[model samples]
Target: MNRRTIQGKYEIFLQKYNEGVKKYIPIYRVKKSIHTWYNAR
Candidate 1:
């Protein structure tokens, strides 16, 4: 795929992932230091 297409897809994927995370987990409860296992798909 082209760079632009890959970038657009990545943004969409990230937005959806963020929304999913917010839906399941409270924003204030998310600790970056404690949750180092989370990785970008």
Candidate 2:
């Protein structure tokens, strides 16, 4: 039972972390692309 609960918590943490990364990745990519374009100009 204790191990199950710990595993559940770890799973939840990973889900949240993955969601956060997913949300930020697009923003990061957009910013990077814009920076590169402006620098090239």
Candidate 3:
């Protein structure tokens, strides 16, 4: 309802989003590498 509360919520949301992305980065990298290898083959 207040500006500070809204900002805090936004920060929390960003933190969770970043963490989720970080967790997925390795999986995505692996998939990308496999795709590239297959394409080269």
Candidate 4:
């Protein structure tokens, strides 16, 4: 039971970790596009 609880918490932490990565990835992608946009203009 203790191990299961730890696993559950770890899973939750991984979910948050993935969510953070997902959120940051799009922002970073947009930032990268800013340079190209100015060049194109």
Using TM-score, give the best candidate's number: 1
Clashing residue pairs in candidate 1 are none
Model 3 misplaced stretches (Cα beyond 4 Å)? 1-4, 27-41
Worst 10 residues of 4 by lDDT: 28-37
Candidate 3 lDDT over residue span 1-41, tens digit each: 26568789899889999999988877533443455546645
User: Candidate 4 residues 1-39, lDDT tens each?
Assistant: 366688898998899999999888765334444565476
lDDT of 1: 0.79
What residue runs in model 2 are displaced by over 4 Å at the alpha carbon? 1-4, 27-41
- In candidate 2, which residue pairs clash? none
Estimate the TM-score of every prediction. 0.51, 0.50, 0.50, 0.50
Arrange candidates by lDDT, highest first: which order? Answer: 1, 2, 4, 3
Please name the candidate that would achieve the greatest lDDT relative to the true structure: 1
lDDT, candidates in the order shown: 0.79, 0.76, 0.75, 0.75
Better of 2 and 3 by lDDT: 2
**Model 1 C-alpha lDDT per residue in residues 1-41, reported as the tens digit of each score:** 36668789899889999999989986565555746577664
- Give per-candidate clash totals: 0, 0, 0, 0
Please, what's the RMSD in Å of model 1? 14.0
Candidate 4 off by > 4 Å: 1-4, 26-41
Point out where model 1 deviates above 4 Å.
1-4, 27-41
Q: Which digits, one per residue and each the tens of the lDDT, describe model 2 over residues 1-41?
A: 36678889899889999999988877533443455546645
